[model samples]
Target: MAVSVTLPALGESVTEGTVTRWLKAEGERVEADEPLLEVSTDKVDTEIPAPAAGVLASIKVAEDETVEVGAELAIIDDGSGAPAAESAPAQAEAPAEAPAAQPEPAAAPAQEAPAQEAPKQEAPAAPAGGAQGSGASTGSTGASGTDVLLPALGESVTEGTVTRWLKEVGEEVAEDEPLLEVSTDKVDTEIPAPTAGTLLEILVGEDETAEVGAKLAVIGQKGAAPAQAEAPAAPAPAQEAPKQEAPKQEAPKQEAPAPAPAPQAPTTPAPQAVTTPAPDPVPAAPAPAPAAAPVTPAPAAGEADAAYVTPLVRKLAQENGVNLATVKGTGVGGRIRKQDVIAAAEAAKQQQAAPAAAAAPAASGTKAPAIEASPLRGQTVKMPRMRKVIGDNMMKALHGQAQLTSVVEVDITKIMRMRNKAKDAFAQREGVKLSPMPFFVKAAVQALKAHPVVNARINEDEGTITYFDTENIGIAVDAEKGLMTPVIKGAGDLNIAGIARKTAELAGKVRTNKISPDDMSGATFTISNTGSRGALFDTVIVPPNQVGILGIGATVKRPVVVDHPELGETIAVRHMTYLALSYDHRLVDGADAARYLTTVKQILEAGEFETEIGL
Candidate 1:
């Protein structure tokens, strides 16, 4: 039997991917779960795995071809049977012309039964590719009534560019959660749910554009809701109303106009009345207005040429502090292009150098020599996709929302003690090195649960705020490409040991670039640990579409005052670390953010369990 391999959806907002390379060639035997091909999307480049142990029979799509999710890319045939000769004409026809044709009929009957069953087995493999194809198999036609439209993401946005579609038709979607990612000119943002229901249909494709009032998708209640019937048509209004009111209002206006002409006849009886209007006309007064315009036209061309110069030359002139008006244009019709402006600028630079060259020696000898100046030099580096996305998001977050940061001192002595005692045994049992991050992750989850707003994101439009019920915590991992935060889903349900195990596994996958795109998504909150670098404290920039991020610093020992319930304050030795919580002030205020950080600190200091216990 041959198993068809299809492309997997990489990210929530990624619809199509280009094949980067094929790891295994056709006719090579591959083990299940081994890497088979590399696929590249805008968000990430990932290696896909083989689905079953088989020999790669054929590769359908070539490298560099962009294919949508669920498109077949390759086929693998298991060692149990050979493919039917009749089904493949090229392989069968060539051999039939050879001397071995006589023995083929005796073997034909034995292979005929298996060929009939091949189509039956191939049907089950189709559902694993995507929800759109699978949902159709179950006969789900989607919901009815009150069309749920795609959401408007921001104020200035009249439409959104659909980056990717997260849910397919008949897939269940939660209320006030991320439905899709929409990109506007200002920022790329996630559109949240207005209500909970199953998605009925996807009205748009990935990279397809849609207007604000237009329907991009629909959501409705699950199961069989009653179909709303069309409303009855309304009767036409009577035609007699307009004719009654037009004649009465026109009679009074007509009578007033007759008396006005009689008053004009009396003015004609006085001869001086006709002479009074004659002096009002003066045609020669307007001739001087045209004479005043020549003064304005003389400088217009020079000013326009200066104002419309190339920005590159303008910047070059500003950095050297040179005026652009003195530079002449050699471009088409005397318009300034970069090369023309640059050539003129070079001449001006040399002219100014003559005076500076004459004055440098005298100034150097007359006074203590000016500090030796180093030339301003640096190389321009291209940013990775992750870094560019991160930079754009940070700028958007700072500009669009009011951001507030709060710091709290946490005593991590108990956490350190716990890790120190169990690090070896835990590593031996789990085959992974356990770190202090899992404990911090647990503490963050606890803090998020106690204060749900920290796990929420602000929907600037519709005047609504959304909070997530699931606790998927994103751990900031530094990779070769850039910084990526792969999420650990349902972190609140995992114990400390489970958190340690999963964090170690995910970190290894991230460093090696083996993490699936789905593993990096649905992150409700984030935690960035800069403590490994020995930095005492640092500010962390917030990732776009997330509400908050907790920054953890290095642990250090210091003498501090302790307050006891029965015994007053006393000086004691304790281990402390600085915790910085940067949150979107649009959703959370200073007081709530402060309280959340304080709660996290309290959970770590009041460690009320054994060293190697459950969460």
Candidate 2:
């Protein structure tokens, strides 16, 4: 019996999803509830677990292909025919085609070998051994090798680029070993080899984009000869006298490509390739060729030295006008990192300064050196999928709602004092650093409970407004990929310490690319801490489905007029920051926005959190 794997309902609004990648390939065994494939929708990217423990028989959908909800994704065959089903499909197809298409070569080799048998007995034996290896493999278990397809990286990621290949062709790899490095929109990770074997071929090269589930490479049976030899053997059957010398001649051609193969090169069919007609001292000479031929072009393109460059590190290098190839990496495995690029850039600037100073008098009257142009000024690379998604969402949100921003200045001198006094104790008790962000979140949630209209959303299709009772506040975290807002559910119910812990946890997840779709959805409101990066308040745009967003600005000590106890008005230095509240005008009027800001301002100014912070 075969079990059908269907795409289950992911969310209420997600009616369809794209099959991003298949974790288990056809004829691969999978346990029940194990991840089978990854499905991506507009809202989230998630994996679909196997419904039953069996051998995957067929895949109805391929990578980057979309299907509606409830569509059958694949079929799993029970133990009744798993072994036969696994090997038989590959053997059946290869044998049926091999015998039919290769009949001419097979016949030609048979006829020519008999006439030259006396002079080339040993030559005939070598070819026979080579032929039998392939023949026996096909007759029994086929050595067609396992296809290494790309796995799903994360939610909403449909495709990935091959950043680097860790193992070259003909290299023996252990099962679950890191075979290559892949970079998707959401994360950069290693794609491990599914089974231990010799790397046979590379289908996708460096910098090439492949959809999830696309075959990236092939892994052949252990100690299998290079597939290149098999190709030349087809044509060698036509030769009359030189039939015995074909394998020896082909051996030299393999050596030309890879001169310095790894020491472990002997493991990859060196015994089989030792069919030298002369007293050939080096049978393993051709071993390196099979592995290095395809990978040789990769280094020539200048990416070999900087194989593990991350997007953040690359962008940093470009912005600083530093050549990545020249920078000595200090990161793990000698990978280039942001600090390495910055250090290289600083060194280059120091070197250029003296030369510029020497020529300063000659160009004394020239205007101060203009800002240097960015290295990416003339380059027009493809926009990342995450950036495109963010742009589209922002544009849709802006067009869908009537939005405006209201700004207010609040004196947070008292709140600052409270945090400074309690931070040490807070960290000791909570096991997490307490930041000013939780205070802002706490105040915003309190205001939302009082002025629900500011937190309410207008449903255009239904022509209704929903004022949520529980405040699920989304904290905007600046991640390497883009701006991600992971929501803290029931924000109104959590105390200041709880809010601090949840915020820290979510922000960590976002930065590390571990945040799931569920952690990002169902926010009744949003808060953007532009102040963290020193912004003086911003008119932050509201995300889709949310009516409002609050922006926090940098706090500074400034002189201000204050009421003195008996002496009347006086000037004092106080901590002051600005807050900008952008809301949908259709649901929240200017008065409502003002009321919400006032409530938040009063909460911060009062500094009434002694009990919550255990101060």
Every candidate's lDDT: 0.60, 0.68
lDDT of 2: 0.68
Which residue runs does candidate 2 get wrong by more than 4 Å?
A: 1-43, 46-375, 460-462
Q: Estimated TM-score per prediction?
A: 0.44, 0.57
Candidate 1 residue lDDT tens string, 1-615: 889899988888577877878877876656565567877764567767778767788999898788999999999886553344213432443434323322332222223222222323332221211123222111112234233444444322334445566776666788877887765433356777667887754544444344444345557775522211110010010011102111111111112222222322211111101212211222232122221112222222234445333334456667656666665655323444445555766777678677766876664666543354456446566554456556765798688767777889988888788777777877787777777787788888988998999999777777788888989998888877777788899999998888888888888777655677787878889999988788887778777778899999998899998896778898878888999999888788899999999989888888754644532
RMSD of candidate 1 to true structure, Å:
32.9
Pick the lDDT winner: 2
lDDT score of residue 374 within candidate 1: 54
